[model samples]
Target chain A: MKNIIIASTSTIHGSGYLDYILEELNTFFKEAETILFIPYARPGGISHDEYTNIVKTAFTKINKTVKGIHEFENPVEAIANAEAIFTGGGNTFVLTDMLHRNHLIEAIQNVVKNGTPYLGTSAGSNICGLTIRTTNDMPIVYPPSFNALALVPFNINPHYLDPDTNSKHMGETRETRIKEFHGFNPQPVVGLREGSWLRVSGDSIVLKGHLTARIFEKGKSPCEVEPETELNTLK
Target chain B: MKNIIIASTSTIHGSGYLDYILEELNTFFKEAETILFIPYARPGGISHDEYTNIVKTAFTKINKTVKGIHEFENPVEAIANAEAIFTGGGNTFVLTDMLHRNHLIEAIQNVVKNGTPYLGTSAGSNICGLTIRTTNDMPIVYPPSFNALALVPFNINPHYLDPDTNSKHMGETRETRIKEFHGFNPQPVVGLREGSWLRVSGDSIVLKGHLTARIFEKGKSPCEVEPETELNTLK
Candidate 1:
């Protein structure tokens, strides 16, 4: 019985950190008293303590204590014993590197698989997918592998933006990048725009949020799915 | 004596392939009879032969013959013996991976260092830097390492874009991304806008084209570099 929230971004425009998703998070982790934050992504080059403090302030609204994994003497043990978990947004490559190097992937996967409520946003959400090949972040660092949590069956493209047809930019559009990914990889990818997320409840992985998420499957035309759509039924 | 032309892109808005830079290439390779093309960074998923054919057509405008390295029985020999070389734009990760996997990084570097009249656009141009860490392309594949040619002193951000001050997008801007890169890395980065290029002749590397390039160094404010500025003097 996995309960997870994979969001496209942490702070939406005109909103404070976690303010947009706090209500859902409160309900998601109501039974839990503490959350172990995985601040390895280090968004904007912030330190682990600084990133965790940001989460701490947000969790105060939900009456939950927040602690960073870096605080523990044994991070793996801390993850395994945490009442809940969260991986924040930053550089996915660096986050993956730290996760793999610390040998915490399997431990966190085991905990989350065993009913630990998990939350991830942006680079964090990218890891819930089978692989991180669909992320839009720059490759600032090299991780051992592209392999991720496989918490979801497919991949994800966070901060997914549509191609500005009128713009003269020669760079590949987000859709084109995902399409190029499909050329070498057969796995499906969901282009989740900001404020959109996948709410995983047991076997049902539903597309939540107000905006439509674009789905791209191998050799198939990409299509948009409405909010509240159950993605498990998608090919 | 390294002779290299690292261009931001192969095609700019409303232009034919390599048309903007063809004159420079003609003068650059005036004495060369045949040019060895590296189509490993196949743009938009084009096949090696197909991409090479495009280069062939363009080279015809300058009365020079073009041959893809893929067509050779020995790729290493083709690089070592080439009169002129060109690595086209596509994916930098794939290009770096292929260069490393085939053990061609050193080979290509050796020839370029010995002065073989090199031309690189986009992904190709990115490799001329210290590492491929600043490329704007998607991480469709994981290269074994982020290291690049190091032919130049600093890293290059090809197709470098300025942040749209009025955009509502929440995703980190290109400037923000580069700043984050500096947080983790100390290497200097040059944001080469489309049509901007670095001309390396002997020990002096000069920024060419009309547009100003953005330079990002660790702990220093980013500054715009004028056309024809000497980048070799940068920190």
Candidate 2:
């Protein structure tokens, strides 16, 4: 049986994503001996020591062997050869660049297509879209081209949050931007907020999140719903 | 010579679209006697009296005779037989829907391709893209599909603005939302703030806005620049 977990982070590596970690492990590795971890999505300068160490700590607690991706020059072989894999998210642009540079996007796509169990977070989860045009991050860098692992239809905007009071900046609102998106689009868009994930088991999809998500489509008013909603029905 | 003037509005009958009114008058007694006006793109509704008055005012002001588009039912023929066409902007979603319903998008594309002078504004500007994925209105309504005129590579997020107030709201910033666009795409995007436009004459595209516009690309940092900068090098 193949299983995958895609998420925004390992909950800062044992902080916010503990439930996600436990669930992924228990669900995909009950009979497996090890979990191959990919961590290339984090920006080079960002602090991930705490996050990485947390993963090690979790594996140590569970008595499971965890392979750090940076240690392998050939990350593709490591991922393809593993019985199962876990993908953690940080910066989607960075992560996607690493995946593209290594030509691992296709390899992973093949792995999932071949029924390999996969778990992803944040940037990892975003790789499954048909196109990443819907992401909510800045294009601070450039890659070979705008290609990504086609796992879903629309782009995933992780770390999604409503504006806070402590900042002083000027820009268009997310709602307005999304409405702008509808003006040029005749398709439906899924705005997934934080603490939310889509779990896919074979042909089934389950949405797990703490808050309601906003849905936008062409020529129609926007709609909101709780986590139990089925997104595929909107099509 | 092929000259295009894309404006925000036109009189269904008269004093708007100064150039269009003047042109219609010349054609009335000469060889050109018809004008193709696309009004479906403005389903928010236009006052017939005001529409007619605008056109009448323009014609009278310029001492030209002209005719309105309401006399024709077949939009395809109306557009196909036109000496010139003017697209008015209101709600881009509604406009896109009507264009799609009448199967006039492809025809409009051909008209522009054929060197016909095409004029538009606001929502009218939204159609010149690979997809309408960048508009700045609500997707409260559904159109045929997310298809657009595709005259350009990326969607045009029209009527854009940088929050004027120092206060912050609980929404995604337009910059952040645009960055999200980069996460999923390597395609170049330009945020056209209001009163700004990309004017293409012959093989040259000139930015007509006095303010700096934001440029986004995947895997790269975002940059803001004045209209005269080296921004139009994008393919």
Candidate 3:
């Protein structure tokens, strides 16, 4: 039953984008009454009415009732009229190019496979996964490719850092570019640092974080998992 | 058991030391007679007698015979008096900081597990991986951490480019820093593009290359594998 959390930020919004977090996103909408915000991913430089008035001041401090996505030209009927569906965070290839030019990434993957209640932060938890390709930033900017939201298979490198002792910024870090992407492809990465997050529910997949997340797999030996644990698809 | 050939380049005998691909490395040592040139990794400004006379002009164009680790004061007896050790590509953190300050990365992994004959071009095939952390320039420069030449378990991002559709370079494009290094680690990458190479001989592994090698993996679906195939590794 699709309960999805997918964070990297809900309040520790970091480097501004309307600094979010709001008590772990109001504990996933406390009880929920109306929380549909989608901010059409800050398109045209910035104006979804200032990112839906910062998601209407975090759903008016948990009172709920927020609606954006430009009052719906039919974002799958405003994400099927919604009971939850949050999705904030900026610039994951500019919100996956406005969720693939408003096709709403397969209608938000069919309203989270009909279970609803999906919430995302930080480039909206990077479109659920399978191919945002890992994302730390600087593809220069393209947006409109749309193949993620598969729920999770690979690609997430969010805000991860630790090789810097002083910061000269030359190139390569983010764990040596995911260890040079395991030298081309073996498929199994996690790196998720920075306060971390990944809930899911129902099918169960926790992994919160304190560090020691590093997985990397190709031939194996880069292991370390131990946050909330539940991930398993690197076969 | 260890018939390695990791190469990328070696022809500076005159003093130039930095950028050398030199005719795909003199057609990869023409017929290989006795190629043993280590040149301790240049970059901090050459002079190991101009980096072993640029490995004696790429082993005198196949006439072979280039010995340098300061003519072996014991690099495990010059990598066990090689029949073929080669290792050429610059700045992989200054060739892993002179093979970990001359301890020689476990004496070149015990001279490739005593099969000897190993050769690694281009940052010496990224020290045969387990942790060069996948090189693509810029650990900025520190070296001597050791633990590569695992023959393959993950880590080797040699040269691999692909972002200049027009070119400006603000950053973030080796496929978005390797899909943000798969969101911080799910593990599985291999973008190896640029004349490519991976030829181990004992347990047998091959993947030469022209194009068509991009695999990602975490939740799955970034396919494309052509070269020589046979690169499994999931454990």
TM-score of chain A of each: 0.98, 0.80, 0.31
Arranged by lDDT with the best first, the candidates are 1, 3, 2
Scanning candidate 2 chain B in windows of ten residues, the lowest lDDT window is B6-15
- Superposition TM-score, candidate 1 onto the true structure: 0.98
Model 3 spans with C-alpha error above 4 angstroms: A1-197, A200-235, B1-33, B37-76, B79-85, B88-98, B101-120, B125-134, B137-171, B174-235
Best by lDDT: 1
Task: Pick the winner on DockQ between candidates 1 and 3.
Answer: 1
**Tens-digit lDDT track of model 2 for A1-235:** 3355444344532344445457556755676677777766543333345545656667665677777776676888887887777776654556666788888888888888777877776666766664444455433334454456765545454555455544332234555555555545444666666556766666555566566767767677877777766665554
| TM-score for each model | 0.98, 0.49, 0.29
- True-structure RMSD, every candidate: 1.0, 9.5, 18.2
Provide the DockQ value for model 2.
0.06
| lDDT, residue B108, candidate 3 | 71
Instruction: Give lDDT tens digits, candidate 2, residues B87-185.
Output: 666556567867888888888878777766665666677777655555554333456665788666555666555653553222345666566555544
Evaluate candidate 1 and give its CAPRI docking class based on DockQ: medium
Lowest summed lDDT across 10 adjacent residues in model 3 chain B is found at B10-19
Please identify model 2 stretches exceeding 4 Å from their true place. A8-21, A47-51, A162-170, A182-187, A233-235, B1-235
